[model samples]
Target: MSKYIPGNQKHLTLVDRIYIENELNRGTTFKDIAKFLCKDPTTISKEVKAHRLSDWYHKGTFYNAKNFCIHRYHCKKTNACGKIILCGVKCTSCPTCNQTCRDFEKERCSRLDKAPYVCNGCPKKINHCTIAHKYSYNARFSNRKYRELLSDSRSGVNLTKHELHKKDRIISPLIEQGQSPYQIVTNHPELELSVRTVYTYLDQGLFTARNVDLKRKVKFKPRKCHKTQISDRTVFINRTYQDFQTLHLESFTEMDTVHSSRDSKKTLLTFFFTKEKLFLAFLMNRCTEGAVRLIFDRLEKRLGTYGFISTFEHILTDRGTEFGDPEALETGANGIQRTSIYYCDPMRSGQKGGLEQAHTMLRMVLPKGTRFEFLTQWDVNLIVNHINSMPRESLGGRTPYSVALETLGEEVLNAFQLRPIAPDEVNLTPKLIRFNS
Candidate 1:
C-alpha cells in the first residue's frame, strides 16, 4: 500500500512518503500536517483531494495508496466516469450514444440545443438554450426584434459634432442677435441642420442665445379699424420725409391721444418732439378743439413764448379727433402762433414718424391706452419732464432739453418765454390811444 507508485519509491523521497502516510493513515490534522511539513494545509488538502479514489464502501479511499494509484491509472487510460453504475460505465445515461442528452423530436443535444421538450441543463426550463449558460452567467439570448435597437452604431445617429457646433456657434448666436430659427436655416442651407435641430441644440445647452438690444421697440398690432371709417388726412410731410435724415427740429411733435384704458372714453393729448426727444402730455376729456387748445396753451406756458415760437415749427399728427383741429390750436395758443401743422394719412398711423418714434420713451411712464382719468396733470407733467430729460439717439444721445438749448441758443431761448395772455390783453387796443383829434 505504501510502495504502490514507482516515483515515490524509486525517487523514494523520505519527506513525500512520510508526509503522505502521516497525513492519510495516521489521520494527522491539517494543522499538524502544516506543522510537520512546514507547508500550507490548503496545498496538502488540494493534493489529497485530487488523488483520492472513489469506491462504494470507502468514500474516496486514500488509505490504500496502491488502490488509489491504480484507480488513477485506469481513469486516465479508459476515459471512464468516476461514478460507475450497477450495469455499466455510466451512473446516468443519456438517450443519445454520444454521451449527450438528445431530444428525440429535434434530434439534437438536449442540453446544448433548443428542443421541443428538453431545455438546457437548467431544470427550471427556458424557451431557448443559450451557449453562455454553460460557461458564464452574463450571456443572454435576445430575440431579433430587440437586437437592432441594442446595437452600438445606432445609439447616437440623431446627433453629431457638426450639429453641436452649429447650434452653439451659429444658430444660437444668430437667434440671440434677433434672427429667428427660420432665418438661420434659410440663410445657410449648407449648414445641413433643421430649425428643429437648432431648437434641440439650444435646449441641450450646446449653444446660448445671443443678447440683442433692439434699437426700435417692438410694435404691437393696432386695433382693427374699418378701412372706410378711417380719416382722410394728408401724409405729404411724412412721405416727403421718410426718416430722420429729412426731418427738422421745428415743433415736429408726434401726437397720440392717451386713454384711461382700452375701453375708457376719456383720453389725453400727447406730443413727442422728435428733434428734442421731448414728451409733452396734457390730460384731455376728448380729442376735440378745446382739449387740443388747452394742451397747446399748457405747452407754451412751460416752454416760454420765445422757446415756444422758435420750437413750435411743425406738429406731426395722426387724424384722431383730438388733433383734427390742429390749425386752430396752433393759431390760438399765444406761444405757438407761428407753428405749422402736419397730419398722417388715413389709417397710416406710422406716417407721423416723429411722435410714433418717441412713443417708446413716453410709454415708460404714460403707457399706451393709459386712461387720462386715472393720471393727474402733475403726473402727466412729470412724465413729460422725464422724457425731455432722457438722452435720445436722434440728437446724438443728447437729452431734448440739452439739444433744444443747443439749437435755440441758451440766452435767446431763455429770453423767449410763455406768459399768461389775458383775454383783455389779447385785445386790439391801440398801444397808447393816439386817436386824440
Candidate 2:
C-alpha cells in the first residue's frame, strides 16, 4: 500500500480505487482499509453501497437465495413446517426442489443493514455461501461514471423561464428606444442582465429587436483610394511626415475634409487633437485650398497670433488637394510662420489616423450621402459639440470636451463653441441634429 498523507482530501483517482478493490478482495475490514487510504471509514462504506450493482430474477426477486426467499410471502402452508415453529424455514435452498416450499420466505443480512453495506471483504467462502449477493469495485467503471456526471453537471443555464422573461421585458424596451445594451445597463440600476448577455440574446433573436435596429450596428463603406498628386511647386518638400516625427512634439492636430453627396462644393473641415481627442469642425463653401486657408485665417484672427500658434503648434494632414497649399497654411497674415504644417506620404491617410477615427463619431450624426448644403457653421458646431461630449473608453470615461476644458482651458472651448452635454443626453444620432434645426 502507498503511504497515506494527511490533508489530501481530493476526489478519488483510479489508482486509489484499484487499491481499494485489492484490499476488499484480501478480506481487509473497511476501517483498516480506510486508515491505510487516509479516508474516513464511513466514506469507504458509502462508496461501496452507492456503486454496488444488483441482479434481480423474475417477479423482482433478487438473484441471491436469501433475498429470493424474503420475497416469497405468498407461499401456501404457513405453519406446517417444523422449522417454522423453531426458527424459520423461508425456503428449501435445494437446487433439485421446485419452489413449492410452503413456508418459503427471504431474509436480509443484519450486517449489511449496519455499516460496510456490501459483501466486499467478507471472510466466508463463495462456494459455501447459498446467497449469490456479491460486491466488487471496478476502477474503470467508477472513473467513467465520474466523468459522465461531471459533464452533465456543467451543461445548462440555471435560470427559470419566469426569470428569463422578466429580464427580457426590462431589456427589450430600452433596446428598441435606441439605447445600447451598454447604455441601458449603465443607466438602469435594476437591470441584472450583463451587457454581453444582452448582446448575445440580441444575436440569437431572443429579443423583439434585431441587431440591425441598433444605431452603431450600421455598416460603413470601405474608404476609396485617391491618386497621389505630387507637385514641385507645392511646399511639402520641407514639411513631410518624416519632418513631423523628427521634432518629437507632444501636441499636434490632425486635419481632414468631410464631403457630402448632396452637394459637391460644400464640405466640413475637421481638426482633431491626438492627445486630448478634442475635435472641431468648420463649414466650408468648397473643398478647395482657398476655402481651407480662409478657415485657418479666420481661426488665427479669432484666437489671435499667440493663441493660434499655441493651440495649433503643428498640423498634420493628408495630401488632399484642399490642403495642397501648405505654404498658405503655414504663413500668418503678417507673412510669418504661424504654425508648421506637415503632409503625410502620398496615399497614406492613416499617417493622420486620429482624425480618421474621430470622423466615425461625426459620421454617426451626419451619415455619408447626407446633404450638408443647408448646414451652417453653427449647425456643424452643434454636431461637433455633441460628438466631443461623448465619453471615450480610452479617455477613462471622460469626454473630449471635459479633457479639452481642463487641458486647453475655457477660452479654447469658447473659441470653438464646444460645450459639454450631460452624459445621458449626449446623443450621437441624426435625429438630434434634425431636432436642433
Candidate 3:
C-alpha cells in the first residue's frame, strides 16, 4: 500500500498524531485516517497496532480482573493442580491454574485482532467488553514510538542495493575517468550524496573506487578525540548541583544515558530510583531533547500529575544536549508542574554515584560496545527485570524490586509494569537476549 505514496510526504507530526487519536476514538476507519493524513492505509494500520497500549481500570470495581481463559466462565473443574484435598479452590478461581492447567486456552476478542486492531473504536461498552486485554492508541505514546522508530530507521546505511548500484554506476565511471568523488558529485548534483559519504563508501569497499584510487585519501589518519562544546546556553539558575545541595532533599531520581558506542545513535535513557535502589531504562533511538520530553510525557501519562511529582520529587542529571530543556521535563502536559530537574556539576558523574553503580550491573548484561539497534522496550524490560532482581549489598541483601515495592507500593510498580524475576533464574549476560543481529 505504501509503494506508491506521495513523494513529498513528511512524517506525521504531533498534531497529526493527536488527530489520529481523536479519529480513532470517534470510530473513524483506517482508510479515512490514511486519506486525511496523506498516508497509506497500511501505514495507519501498522502505526495503530505497533503503538497501542493496554488500557487499565481499577480491577474488580469498574473492570473485572483480567482472566483470558476460554473456560473461565463455565469451568467447574476443581484442583487442576492435582491436589484436590490440599487445593480446595476451583481452577478458574486460582491465578496459577492458567499456568498449570494443560487444557487452558486463551480467549481473545476478534475485533481487536482485525483492521482497527484496538478497543478504542469498539461498539461494545468498555465495561461490558469481554476482551481479556484492552488496547488503545494514545497520541502521546504513539508519537514517541514513531519518533524512536524513525530515528532507528535513519541510523546506519540507509541506501538499498539497487540505489547503491545506481549511484555506483554513476560514481565509479567518473572516478575511472580521473575525476575525484567531490568533482563527480559537483558535476552531477542528482547523485544526492556528500563528498565525505562518497569517500566513506569507497573506503568501505561498497564502490568500485578504493582509497588506492584517490591520490590523497589514504594519507590521512583518523582523529581519536573529537571535542564537543556544551550546546544551548540557557543558564540553569537555582537548578545546579550547589542549589540541589542546598535543598537537602531526602531522596531523588538520578538520570543518565548509556551509549553503545560514540558513533551509535541508539542509547538507553536510564533512571535510578535512589530511595528504592531500582533502576529503569528505556531504549531511545536518538538521545535528543524531544526524545527526553517524550519519555517525560510517557511517565507523566502513566503516573499522573501528583504521582509523578511525588515519585520524581527531584531529578538529578548531567547537562547533556539531550537534557537541555529542563522546563519541558519539569512541566506536565496539562500545564501542571510535575517535578524539579537538577543538573550535576561538569565531569562529576560520581555525584549520582548510586546510578553509576547501577550502570555497572547494566554493563554485565549489555557489555560496552554492544549494539542496541536490535533491542526493543520488551528487551529492555527483561534486562531491567534481571538487574532489579539481583540482591544488592547496599539494600541489605534485598533485591531492588522488593525495596521498590515496599517503598513505592504495588500500584506504582504496576504503572511501570515492573516485575521481579526469581534470583536463581536471573541471567546477566549477552546470552540473555539473543539478538537477531
Candidate 4:
C-alpha cells in the first residue's frame, strides 16, 4: 500500500502524471522523471509531494485510520494534566515538622503522646527545650548566675602591692599639710584618685598642720556678723604703744606707687609722713627694691647728715612681689640700719588706709594691670612733682609740698634743694582732693 503522489490539479499534463507513477509505484527515481519530462529533479519531487489527497484525509494522508487517528497535545510553559484536588494539611517539606498533628512547625511541644512531638531524628534536635518554648524561662538562664559562679571561683579581690605603694606615697604629704581633697588633686595630678578617697583618709584621722589657709592655699569664709577674721598682730601693736600723738616724724611713714596706665614703666613712689601729714613723691625707673634703695640714696645725698641720722621706724605694704624681700629695700651702703616691715592682712584693705586711698587717686590716671615698662624717668618726675604739689584734704586743703615746708621748716626743706614753684606756677587757690579713707 504505497501513497500516491500528486502532480498539477489544473490542466494536468499526461507526461507529469506518468512521471509521478513511474517515480513512486515503479521505483523509478525523480531524476528519471526529470529526464523523461524535461524538468528539474527538485521540481518533479515537489510536484509529486504536494497536491496529493485521500478520499477523506485531513490535508495530505492515506485512509489508514489506525496511524492517522493518533494525536498528541503539547504545552511549552505548563503541564496539560494539572491536579484539581489540594490537601489542606501541613506539608512534610516544612522545616520543623511533617503534617502528623494540627500544630504547625514552631517550637517543639513537650507532650509525649502527640504524633508531631519533637523526635530524635529531627534535623535541629529541638526536643524537650524549655527556653525556646516559654518566655518565663529567661530568669532561670540569666547572666547573674554565671557571674556569681565566676566570682566564687576567683581567688582574690583587693589592691595590688604596687597600687598601694603609689597611693600611699602621694596621699601622705597631702594629708600632712591638711590640704583639702580638691586642693591636693589639683596641685598633684599624679595622685590619680577621687576626692572621696581623701575624705575617707581624713575620716580615718591621718595628718595635720598649723595654718589652714596656707595648707589649702585658700581663705575661710567670714561669719555673717563679721567681714574678716580677727588678727593676733594687734597684740604686738600693744607692745609698741598706741600713743601716736607723741611720736616723732621719723617713727613711721606710709609708702605707695602711682603711675599712668599709658606709662607704667615709670612709677612715682610716694612716702607720706604719718605725724605731720607731709608727703613726698619720687620718680622711679622700676618697682624693684633696687630702684627704691636708689631713691633713698638720692634723698640721703640731698638732705646730707640729717637724712642719714634720722631713724626709719616702720614700712607698711601690700603683698606686691616688688616688696617680696624687705631686706633688699633696707640695705643702704652708708649707715642705714634695719627697718621693721609689716604686711597688711589679706582682704583687709582698711589696714593700709592712707596708701589705699592714694592708690584710688592714682587709678584715675593709671588703672589696674598697668605695665611699668614704657616710661622715661623724666616723665615720671614731672608727674610725681605735680601730684605732690596738689592739695590734700588730710592736710587742711594745703598742698603736700606746702605742708612739708611748714612742718619741716623752710631751712630743712631747703636742705634738699627742691625747685621752688614760681608765683605763676603756684596756685595758692586751694582745692581739696577727696577720696575714700
Candidate 5:
C-alpha cells in the first residue's frame, strides 16, 4: 500500500493503532507500517514499546512469554563466563541449570533496538527462542489509556490557589467600582489575565464578585416585537422608508418610544440624531399620538420656525401607535410643514438602527420593567445628559454633547435643554439615576 499523507495534524485514532498491531503480528516491518500509516517509523516503534505487555515464568510453567523477560539482555557477564564452553546460549534459557550463575547474562536482538522495538514481527519461534522477551500491542488498552490521559490533562484549573487569590484581590475592587473586566485589564498593566478569563472566573464564582455584579452580565427577557400589518389607512402609505432614503438626507433624527411595565402609563420618547449620535429623552404621561404631537409642538415653539426646520428637517421612526399620526407630527399648528416624517417598514426597526443601539445604553440605566410612572422630565433630562456626555468611539472619542454643541451650536442645545456632563461625571448605571434622585 502507498503511504497516506494527511493534510492536517490529527490525533492517532484507534484504527491506526489496531492497524499497527495487526501488521506487527503479520511480521511487517515498522518502516513499511509507518509508510502505510503516513507516520514516522520512530512513532510506530515507540508505540509498541510503550504499551506492549511483558511476563515471566519458571521452566515448565504454561506462560505466554512473548514479550516478558525480567533479565533479558541486561547482564554483561554472559560472554566472559567460564561455563560458556559447556552451556553456550542454552545456559541462559535453562531455568533449572544454575539458580545463580556468576557469568549468567541475557541478550536482546539488535532489531528490537533499531526499528520495530518489539518481537511481534520476529521470525524466531516463541517456543525455541532463547530470549524470553516479548512485546504485544493491545488496541483497547492503549485507547483507554489515551482517553484517561486526555481527560486528566483537561480537568484541573491552570491557576494555583495563591495566584487565584492575587487575581481576585485586584479584580474584585475594580468590579465593585463599576469597572468592566475589559476596562480593568486594559488599565492595569500588572494584571496578566485576559478579559475572557476574568469573566470566566466571575461566572464560576471564583472571585468576590459574581456575574450579577456586572451590569452587562445581568440577563433580561428579550423584547418581543409584534409585527403590525399596514393597511390603506396606514400613515406609511404616503412616506415609505424607500422614499426617505431616495432623498439622501444626510441629517435626520430617529424616534422611538421606550415603555416601562404594562402597568405604568408613562413612557420615554427617545430621539437620536444620526450625525452627532446625540440622544434625547422626554418623559410622557402616556404613549399616545397626542402626547407625541404635544412634545413636537413644544419643540417647535422653543426652537421657532427656522431652528425647528433645521433641527428636524427629516424624521424617521417605526410604525408605532404613538407615532400613528404622521400628519400631526409633520405639520405645525398654523398648517405649515414644519418637518417631514417617514415610516420604516413594518418589523424593520433596524432601518433606524442608531436609535435602537442608543436604547441599549438607556437600558443600562433604566432597565426594562423599571417603573417610569414616578420619573419626571428633569430625571429624563439628567439621563439624556449623561448618555450624550459619554465618549463615542465612532465619533473619534468625542462626546455627543460636544459634537452637538459644535454642530448645532449652544443656542440649539440650550433650547432642547441638552447639557454636557463632565467626562468623569458621566455615568451610565442605575446608581447614577438613584443618586440624582
Candidate 6:
C-alpha cells in the first residue's frame, strides 16, 4: 500500500504514514511524496514537523549524556565544582557540568527549519546527533495520536440531563414493574427509542432499572446451540414431551445441570419439584451421562426404591447431552421400573420454566464463570437448604421446606436433611458461598 487511490476520505491512514517514513529515509522530496498520496505538499510537511519525537536512548548507555551545551566542543573547562586546583576532569564530559556552567547555551537543531523536519532521513547515527537533540517520526505512534485526537474532536452528549431524565422516568418504572423494553417501546410511542437502544441505556446505567430487574433477560442466555452429532437419535422416541403429556401426571420434577464455567469440568445437577417447589443440587466432578445415571442410582439407594418411585413418579427434563441416556436412570439394578423420564422439545427450556427460575437462586451464590472444582456435596446441600427455605409470594407466603415436609413426608425431608433458614437470615447474595475456600 505505497499510495491509496484518490478518494473523498480526508484523514491520513497508517499506510500513508508508513510510506512517508520510508520515502523520507530514501531522501524523497515532500512534493513527490504528496503527489503519490494525492495530498498537498504543505500537509505532508506539517504532519512530519508536528508529530516528531525526541530520541533519548543515550541516557541508559551513557550516564553523562545530559550535556546540551552549544559550546561543548570549543570551551574545555575542568573542575566544575568550587576547587582551588583543577580536579583533572573536563567539564564538557562531567555529570554535573551543565548545572554549574553559568554560560550554558541550550543547543537547537537548525536543520528542522528546512523542508523535511524529522531525523528519519539523517545520514549520521543517533549517538553523534544527540549533542543537539534528534527527533524521529514513527508511523504507529503518529497514527495512534491522530486517532485519539479524532475521538476527542467530536462533541459531548447530544441530549441534556432533563431530556434524559424524562425518558428515564417513562422507561425505568415500567421496566421495574415487569415490562420488557420491546413492550415499553411498542406501548408508549412517545419513547421514540428502539428496543435495543433501551437495553443499551439500561446497560450503561443511564436508567434506574438495571439488567437484574429484567428477571427473565438476565437469567438465561438468548441462545443455547449444540452442533454435535447424535450417536443415537432413537433414544428420544416415546419419551418425547408429547408422550409425557398423555399421562397427565399431577406432579413432577424438572431436572437440569448448572455449569460453574465453560472451561471448568465440574458441574451441578439440579432437581426442582413442580408441586412442592423444593430445589436440590448435587455437585459432580464432570457433567456426563454416566455421572447423571450414577446420581440417580445414589438417590434411589438413599431414598429406598419404593420411596424414590413415589417421590419421582414422572420426571421432565431438557434434551441436554448429559441427560441423553434415560433408560439407565428409569430402570433400577434390580430390574424394577422406578420412575419414567421425559424430554422437553428442542430449544424449549421454558417447558420446565419452574426449574429455569430456580436456576436464578443458584446463580446468586455461584454466578456464571465461577469455578466449582473445589466445592463438595456438603456445600451444595448447604446452598439448597437456604434456597428452599426462602418465602415466595407464589407459595402463599410459605417456604418450599414447609410445603415439602407435609407433601413429600417428614421422613423424606429428614433423609435429605433439608432445614429452614430464618426469614431475616436468608442471604441470597454471592457472599453466601465462598469459592476461594
- Alpha-carbon shift of residue 418 in model 2 (angstroms): 1.2
lDDT of 2 by residue, 1-437 (tens): 22254733767777877887787777678889788778877767777777665532322333334434543434433334343465444343333123545544545665466655556556653434334444446667767777788799986544687876777787788878888899988887676778887777787777777888788865755457665353554577778889889999877999988888854579999999988999999999888889999999999888888899999989998877788778888899988788888888877878888899889989999989998877888888888888888888989998898898888899977988777878788788898779878
275-379 per-residue lDDT for model 6 (tens digits) = 889999988887899999888888888899999999988999887788888888899878899999898887788989999999998899888898998788887
Candidate 5 accuracy as TM-score: 0.48
Any runs in candidate 2 off by more than 4 Å, and if so which? 1-230
lDDT of 5 by residue, 322-429 (tens): 887788898997788999989898788899999999999999999999999778888889889999989999999999999998899999999889887888887889
For candidate 6, the clash count comes to 0
| Model 3 ranges off by over 4 Å | 1-229, 435-437
Query: In terms of TM-score, which candidate is stronger, 1 or 6?
Result: 6
- The candidate with the higher TM-score, 1 or 4, is 4
Position 168, candidate 2: lDDT: 77
C-alpha lDDT score of every prediction, in listed order = 0.49, 0.76, 0.83, 0.48, 0.79, 0.83
Clashing pairs in 2: 69-105, 69-106, 70-105, 70-106, 90-104, 90-105
TM-score of each: 0.36, 0.48, 0.48, 0.37, 0.48, 0.49
- For candidate 3, what is the TM-score? 0.48
List residue ranges in candidate 4 displaced over 4 A.
1-251, 258-267, 308-313, 336-340, 369-374, 411-437
lDDT of 1: 0.49
lDDT of 6: 0.83
lDDT of 2 at 17: 77
Worst 10 residues of 5 by lDDT: 60-69
Question: What is the per-residue lDDT of model 4 for residues 248-319, given as tens digits with 9 covering 90 to 100?
Answer: 334466676665455556667776566555445676777676787787677666665345445345666554
Cα lDDT of model 3 overall? Answer: 0.83
Question: Cα miss at 340, model 6 (Å)?
Answer: 0.4
